[model samples]
Target: MKSHYSDAPKAQPILRHTLSVLVDNEPGVLARVVGLFSGRGYNIESLTVSETEHEQHVSRITIVTAGTDQVIEQIRHQLERLVPVHRVTDLTVQGESIERELALVKVAGKGEARVEALRLASAFGARTLDATVTSFVFELTGSSEEIERFLRLMGEVGLVEVSRTGIAAMARGAETI
Candidate 1:
C-alpha cells in the first residue's frame, strides 16, 4: 500500500542568503538587531555594518545567514518590524548582486616555503601589505568562496593568522533598497 505522504516533495533545502538592512545609526540599534538572531537561535555567517548617510544618520547592515525559505522569511519579517529598521532586502533572492570580503593573512615561513607562499599569493592577486625576513602579510579581496580557497592553499604554505572583514553586498542595477 502507498503511504499517503509518500509522493510529497522533500523538505525545502537550506540556502545561504545575504540580507541588506537599512536602519538608523543610533546606539544600541545593532545590538537589538543581533539580539533578534541570538534570541531565535539563528546563525549569522557574516555581518557588516556601517553608517552610509551621515547627515541622515542612516546605516547599512549586510548580513549573511543560512536557513530554509520559511525561516529566512520569518527573519526578514521580524527585522522589518523593528523600530529603527528602515528597509530590509534579501539581496540573494532580489536579483543580481555583488558580494565581496577582504582578508588580511599573515604567513610565516622561510626558504622554499616563503617562495611558494609569495608565488601563490601573486597568482591569487593578493597584495603584499607587509613583509619581513620571517613573515609576510597579504591582503586579499574576493567572494567568500574565493577567500576560503586562498586561505586553504595558504595554510599548506605557512598561514599564521588571518583577519576578515565580513561580506559587503549590493544589488547590481539601479534598484535601491
Candidate 2:
C-alpha cells in the first residue's frame, strides 16, 4: 500500500461569471434566489432583474458573481432546481456573450475641471443627460470596466454623484434564455 497525498491538484482560481436566470414574475421569487446565494456564502458583484416578457409573466435576472468553476456549476445547478426558475444560463461560460451596464454620473465644476470632464465624456461617448451652470449629468452605457474608467477620470475632475444599473447580459447570436 502507498500514499499519494503529495500529488493533489492545484486549487482553481476564482473567476468572475455572469448568470442570467429566467424566472416567474411573481412574489418571493427574487428573495428565494437571493437567499440561495446568501445561505451558500456566495458574493454577488452585480445584480439586475426586470420583467422582460410582460405577457408571459416572466422576468430575467442577471447576476454577476465570482467563484471557482466548481462553485459556479453548483450554483447553476441549484438555481435550476428552484421551483420558479425556468432557466439559468452562465453567460460567461457561454461563447460570445454581450454584457453592458448603464450609469449616470454627475460632476460639478467651475473651471478647467468642467472642460476636462466634458472632453472625457465626449471621448467615452457618454451623452449629456442634463446640464446646468455648475453641474452636468452624463449618461454612459458600456462594459463595467469602461464605466469604472470613466468614473475614475470623472472623480479626478469633479465627480459629485453616480447611479448605476447593474450588469445586463445575454448570449450573442440567435440564442434565447
Candidate 3:
C-alpha cells in the first residue's frame, strides 16, 4: 500500500476563544450577529455589546466561545461576511488581552453559613451590593473562571441566585481593534 502524502497535522482539542467585533450600530444588527451564532449552532459562553464610537455609529461586541480551531476560524469568517459588521478581531489569536465579567450573587442563610459567605466574598474582592437580615447580595468583577469559582464556593455556603453581565474583552497594548 502506498502512503498518502498528508500535509495536515492532527486535530487539536477544543479551546475557549474571545472575539471582538466592530459593527454599525443600526437596527437589526445585533439580531443578525446573534443569528449567525445560532444558525451555526455555536455556543456563546459570554456576550457583551455596547456602542464604542458615536461619530462612526459603531458598536463593539465581545463574545466568549469554546470550540476547536476550525470552528473559531469559521466563526470569524462568518461574522466578517455580515453586512453591518466592519471588523472582527479574535482576541484569542491576537496575543495578550484582558477579559472581565461581572456577576451579582445572592445568598440567603442563617448562623455560621451567612458569616462564612460574607468572609469568602470579601476574600474574593466582591462587594456587598445589598444586605438584609437573612440575605446578602454581592457584586463581583473578574475573569470568568474567578466568577465560576466564587459561585461554586457560594453554593457550598448558601447560594440563592446569580446574575451575570457576560464578558468584555480588549487587547492589552496601544493597538486598538
Candidate 4:
C-alpha cells in the first residue's frame, strides 16, 4: 500500500508569546484594543499598559498569551490595523528581553502557619507591606512563574487574596519594542 500524503488538519502546537504594542495615549484606545481580542475570541493571559512616552502621548501595552503560530501572526496583523496602534512587536521572537510582574499576596494565619508564611516569604524575597496580628500583605515582584509558585505556597499557609499587575516587558538593551 502506498503511503498517502496526509490531508488531515494537523494539530497546531500552542506557544506562549509576549507582545509589546505602542499606541497613541488617547481616550477609548485601550478599550478598542481589548475589544479586538475579545471580539475575535483570543485569550489574553496577562495585559499591562502605561504611557511610556509622556511627551509623545504614546502608550505601551504588554500582552502575554498562548496560541498557535498562525493565531499569533493573525493577532499581530490585526493589532497593526487598529487606528491608534503604532507598532506591534512580539518580544518573544525579537531576541533577549526582560519581563517582570508585580503581585500583592495576602496571607491570613496565626502561630505555626504564620511563622511558616514568613519563612517562605523570606526565601522568596517577598516583602511584607502591611501586617496585623492575624494577617500579612506581601509585595512580590518577579517573573510570572516565580509569583505563581509563591502564591501556591501561600495557599498551603493561608493565601487569602492576590492582585497582580500583569507583565511589564522590554528589550534587554537599547532596542525598543
State each candidate's clash count: 0, 0, 0, 0
Query: What lDDT tens digits, residue by residue, belong to model 4 across residues 145-175?
Result: 9999999999999999999999999989875
Between prediction 2 and prediction 4, the one with superior TM-score is 2
Clashing residue pairs, backbone N/CA/C < 3 A, model 4: none
Candidate 3, which segments miss by more than 4 Å at Cα?
Answer: 1-9
Candidate 2 vs 3: which has more TM-score: 2
lDDT of 2 at 42: 99
For residue 32, what is the lDDT in candidate 2?
98
Model 1's alpha-carbon lDDT is: 0.97
lDDT of 3 by residue, 1-177 (tens): 665657567778999999999999999998999999999899988889999999999999999999999999999999999999999999999998999999999999999999999999999999999999999999999998999999999999989999999999999999777
Winner on TM-score (1 vs 3): 1
Q: Which scores greater on TM-score, model 3 or model 4? A: 4
Where in model 4 is the C-alpha error above 4 Å? 5-9
Instruction: Arrange candidates, best lDDT first.
Output: 1, 2, 4, 3
Task: Show the colliding residue pairs in model 2.
Answer: none
Candidates 1 and 4 compared: the better one by TM-score is 1
- For model 1, how does the per-residue alpha-carbon lDDT over 42-159 read when each residue is reduced to its tens digit? 9999999999999999999999999999999999999999999999999999988999999999999999999999999999999999999999999999999999999999999999
Q: How far is candidate 2 from the true structure (C-alpha RMSD, Å)?
A: 1.9
